[model samples]
Target chain A: MSILFDIAITAFLIISGVFGLVGSYGLIKLPDPMSRLHAPTKATTLGVGGVLIASMLHAIAVEGQVSLHELLITLFLLITAPITANFIAKAHLHRHVERDQLPDAAPDDCWAVHDIEPFQAGAEPSTETTK
Target chain B: MIEYAIYFAFGCFSLGLLMNLWQIVFASGVGDRVLALDTMVINMIALLVLFGLMAGTEMFFEAAMIIAMLGFVSTVAYARFMLRGNIIE
Candidate 1:
């Protein structure tokens, strides 16, 4: 049993380490900002997740105590990573991309970040047409 | 075996942190720099967890959680500032 736990912990640690390395490498090697964004958000998040899981397993299987604190970090990370990615992507769009450079938005809708008018609360919606 | 694995993980994450530093230094745009900083924060969290495991203590969990929250907030703030020219509006 102890050996099994050791194997599991070792495997997780190595896997996560490799993932973290690859993510960072991609962040450096990727050609452009948008593609670079893809590397760390997905890969490093999984890498950190693996480390967190290994930590939890070590606490439970080796230390003989249940530690769920790592779970909170994991949950927090899972919740925020996508939001961070979205914000970064939006920032990229706003700062670097021109409207015509992008593929067209849906027929009736434009990108929210590019919208000219702020949406008002409890007010009638604007009927302005988007190009 | 686990000891060696821990060492390997340490080396990998440390190298990753160095790479993130390189990205930050040589990035082409503000977004890329922000992305690098976010990656650096994550690598730091991984290192902290590894340290806790090596030292056999749970005390670092709080530190890791705090760093995670701060990192997320800072990334959002940077992105927001880039998007709107201001952080709070």
Candidate 2:
């Protein structure tokens, strides 16, 4: 029984931490705000969610107890991540400075398409890529 | 079998930390910092949950909740800053 518990908890810890790392990587590696947005949305939320669920499972399976705090947090994260990411993306576009030159505006800065082409304007975006 | 899973998780965490840390250090602009911070929060929530599991108690779950709430507020603040040029605005 002790061995089983040890195995489960260790796996849960490692998995939880890894997902966080991958999402952060995406935050760093992607070229632009739009592209980088996908990394954390897809990886960290689900990855962290998975780890947390595993922990919950262990809590119940090992001790026959139930907890709502983690579950509620997971639920909150799932709902907020996309909405917040979208808000940031929209705000970014509105204030992005080069909105006038973007080739893929979706009738508004907030809804612009991902295929924005700057060079097609015969001039690179005057606003340097932020990094 | 579980140890292998642990190895996998460790490898993933290290790789993620490397990426986020790289971005935090090398990237310019406030947006980069905001995004990295968001990612860090996501990692933290998971960490807290697993820690709760490690202790075999529900204590870590509350920490996870607090972390999640912080993540939401921070993102909103960042978005507000981007939009109105100030979080309070």
Candidate 3:
């Protein structure tokens, strides 16, 4: 279509592609699983958003109609990524990560997955509510 | 020019996909592999959308959406299994 439209689409595509590559690189290169979690959840989400927006713009320019499906996919992805990250992090905390490595929580505020009783504490707050 | 840019972007995504696959194969822990798989799924979505743009077809968009849904579901399932040692329980 128009040069400006072409440039915009190209820009979106390239920027997204770069982010995708960087996220994947971080996923592979990061030393810790916790650190790796940061890569795809944030960067890759934005990358896919960019590509989807570019697709929407292209569809609108070429077919003269709005493409709403991409928006749905974007919404679904945005909603799910964090949930998935949370579950995975919880799983890691339960099965792999050391308890000492975790941020100190009040004894009553224990994570639900941990299944430990709210430990009695004299000094620290009882944040361990899960057990 | 736009066509060339699309090709370059595709190349970048492909490289990223390959990297993710490598990590998935060699990752030390299940969680690491799962995380890599999640990243791979995202990269795949981006690649599929780029393909749809290049080909001027919307069909790949449907595939991308389906993959996005399935990937998240599977990740959640895996995480639950890891946490509780089972999916449903």
Candidate 4:
């Protein structure tokens, strides 16, 4: 039983480590700010979340007491990552992208960042090409 | 064995921190730097949690939670400043 618990913790730690490395590599290798945004938001969120879970498990195993505090960190991270990504994306669109490159929005709609929504409802997704 | 796993996680997170630092330094736009900073804070929180486990301590969990809040606030402020040239306005 103890062996199985150890295995679970180890597995989660390894998985978290791998995702964290991939996220970092993606941040460095990906081209353009918009493309790079995908790396840290998605991968790091998973990586950190995994690590936090492993921590919770370890505490329970070692202390024999349910350690629920780690869950608060995980919850806080889960809530904030997407908001951070959205704000950073909006900032990127407002300051760096060209007008024509941005998609058209409804005539009356106004984006708070730059008065322009960068994505159109029907616009094709940007090609995934690593640089 | 668990100790070894914790050490491995430490190395991975350290590498991530370095990458974020590089991005913050070489980024072409303010948004990239802001995002990198945000990611760095997350990595730090993960590292703190792992360290807490390795040391068999509970104090780090509170620290990690506080850092999470600080990181989010800073990320929002940076993004807002970039977008409007004024965070409060």
Top TM-score prediction, candidate number: 1
lDDT of 1 by residue, B1-89 (tens): 98899999999999999999988898888899999999999999999999999999889999999999999999999998887676665
lDDT scores of the candidates, listed in order: 0.90, 0.68, 0.83, 0.85
> For candidate 2, what is the TM-score?
0.74
Which tens-of-lDDT digit does each residue in A1-131 have in candidate 3?
Answer: 47888899889888888888898888888888888899889989988898888888888777889989899989999999999899888878887866666666776554555653333334464555424
Best first by DockQ, ranked = 1, 4, 3, 2
The CAPRI quality class of candidate 4 comes to medium
User: Where is model 1 more than 4 Å wrong at Cα?
Assistant: A116-131
Off by over 4 Å in 2: A1-19, A102-131, B1-11
Order candidates by lDDT, high to low: 1, 4, 3, 2
> What is the two-chain DockQ of model 2?
0.48
lDDT of 4 by residue, A1-131 (tens): 78887999999999998899899889989988878999988999899988988987887788788888978888888898889999889888888777667667656343455553244455664676322
lDDT of 1 by residue, A28-121 (tens): 9988888888999999999999999899889989879988999899999999999999999998887788877888788746677787544445
2 versus 4: better TM-score goes to: 4
| Model 4 superposed RMSD (Cα) | 8.6
TM-scores of the candidates are 0.91, 0.74, 0.88, 0.89
Q: Is candidate 1 or candidate 2 better by lDDT?
A: 1
lDDT for each residue of candidate 4 in B15-40, tens digit (9 for 90 to 100): 99999999989878778788889889
DockQ of all models, two decimals each: 0.68, 0.48, 0.59, 0.63
